[model samples]
Target: MKHKKYQITCPYCDSPALFRPASMVHGSSVLEKGRYLYICSRWPACDSYVAAHKKGKRPMGTLANKELRHKRMLAHRALEELQQSMHMEKWAVYLWLQGHLHLNEEQAHIGLFSEQMCEQVISLCRQLIRTSTGTTA
Candidate 1:
């Protein structure tokens, strides 16, 4: 499918931004009315994000900023919860690896949890949890 591009400003750094068509999902359009996702060109450093729509593209001044704020809050809360859960699981796994798996000191040190790997494990856990609970993590 063809996608459009837009020039935007990074919400965090106010730098020039670009929104290229990434993908299209089946359920809903990510770039639909009242919604937009623009990524900063200087990614992995700037890490800026803007979740807003273009002028005249959506109902002027009628966008639910409050609802958007609430959704952001919920998303942040969910992320925090997931982080905590993942931390606990990581510690448990570390302990298990050290105790039950009987890894030596050097092996245990090498097997120490990396945040990136833990994040992947946490993502998997989130998927499983969502599949079972029918809720977002």
Candidate 2:
């Protein structure tokens, strides 16, 4: 796959940033978002960050504040539950999400989603799980 470089910036402050390990960013051995994380160069003031994929420096998505990060986590959990309930493979669940959300494959990731989109993911996942399992989810 051709990896596209992400020009990540603080959503709040619009500052230049750096992509490094979360441990370095936090000044501690924090393994929350794999080993790689992006932080605003003006961090401590801007407080924006994004986690990279486990194996690469590529960001998982756009930089976010605490609120957006929480919403993304909620969406991710709901997606996981929905996938398990439907007994679907990860790629298939992502395909379903892309089609339902009117997103192209490249834009289907929860990490790239807004708060509204995250809520939509939870709602859709609930509906899908309920129908698939024939029980309220």
Q: List the lowest-lDDT window of 10 residues for candidate 1.
A: 56-65
Per-residue lDDT for 1-137 in model 2, tens only?
66666677777798866877688666565444458778888876777788888765788888888889899999999989988878889999999999999999999998899999999999999988877678545
Per-candidate TM-scores read 0.26, 0.84
* TM-score result, candidate 2: 0.84
Pairs of residues clashing in candidate 1: none
Task: Report the C-alpha displacement of residue 106, candidate 1, in angstroms.
Answer: 59
lDDT of 1 by residue, 29-126 (tens): 65454454454666536654444345432211111223333444453344455446555564554454356336654544321323333344445446
- The candidate maximizing lDDT is 2
